[model samples]
Target: MFDSFVFMAPPLPDDLVTRYFRHCLEDSLFTLRRQVRMARMSGRFGANDETRLSLMPMILQSLLEDGIRDRLPLQRVDPEWSPETLVIAMHLYSVEARRIQSPEETRRIQQTFPDIKTPDFTSAEHTGQLREAYIAARLAALRDGTTPTSLSIGIEL
Candidate 1:
C-alpha cells in the first residue's frame, strides 16, 4: 500500500516544495519550544537541548523566503517523495544552507550535536545517501504502521 503511494505519486511543484520547507521550519521550532518547556518542567532540559534551542533560530532565519528558494535543490524532491520525505530533505538542506550562510553558527551546532549529518548538495553521493535514508525510514515507518514525523529529522531541538 505504501509502496504503491511511493511509486505513483507525482512530483511536487517547486513553489509547493518551498512552502513545505517554510512550514516545516516553523513547525519544527514550535514543536521544539513545546518540548523544551515540558523538559524544563520535568527538570530534564539539558545542555544539548539548550544548544539546539539557541542555534535553531539562526538556521531558521537564514532559510526564510529567498534563502530557501535559492538554496533548495528542487530536483532532489523526487516524484516518489512523500511530504515526510520532503521534510527530511528540507531539513538536510537547511543544515547545508546554514553551514554555507553562517559557518560560525553551523560550527556551534556541530560542536554540540557531533552526530548530526548534513549533506553536500553538490555531491551526487551525498544526495543519494539522503534519498536512500529517507526511503528506508519511510518504509520502516509504514511497516510499523506509523507515519514519519517531521520532528524526527535529526536537527530538531
Candidate 2:
C-alpha cells in the first residue's frame, strides 16, 4: 500500500564545509583564470575606483604564495611585475597547472591547501554588469603606477 513518502535526509559529511570551500575555489579560480587572461581585458577596467585595484596586489600575493608550495607560479611570474601584470601571469600559471594535473588536480590541490578558496574578493559579476566593480576600482592604480592608491606595490610586484 502506498503511503505518504518518508523524507530522507541527504548525507552531509563531517568535512562538508571543507568540501564546499574546495568546490567553490575550483569554480572561482577557473573563471578568474580565464577572465585575467582574456587579451585586451585591461580596457574593461574603468579609470577610477582605486579600491578595487587593491585586488591586483592581493591576487599577486596569492599566486606568489601558491608558487611557494608549487614551482609553477614562481616560474611563470616576475617578481618585478605589477598587480595587473600578475593577473595575466597567474592566469597563465593556473591554466598550465590545470593542464599538467589533469582533471584530478583540483581535488588534490584542495587537499594540500585547504584554505585556497578563502579569497575575500566579493562577487565581480551581477545580472549583466560588473557586480563587485573591482576592475573599475583598480583602474586608476593600474594606469598611473604611482598614484596614492591603497594597494600600490611601489617596489614592483
- Model 2 clash pairs are 49-137, 53-138
CA lDDT, every model vs. true structure: 0.43, 0.39
Please give, for residues 3-115, the per-residue lDDT of candidate 2 as tens digits: 22221322223364344444544555444444443422566545332434444555434433443223344444568867876665556455543443454643343343343
State which candidate has the highest TM-score: 1
Cα lDDT for residue 127, candidate 2:
8
Tell me how far the alpha carbon of residue 41 in candidate 1 is from the true structure, in angstroms, after superposition.
Answer: 1.7
Candidate 1 residue-wise lDDT at 67: 45
Write the residue-wise lDDT of candidate 1 on 52-133 in tens digits.
4443333334343234444455544457756655565567566656454365643432232223334312333333233323
What RMSD, rounded to one decimal, does every model reach?
16.6, 16.8
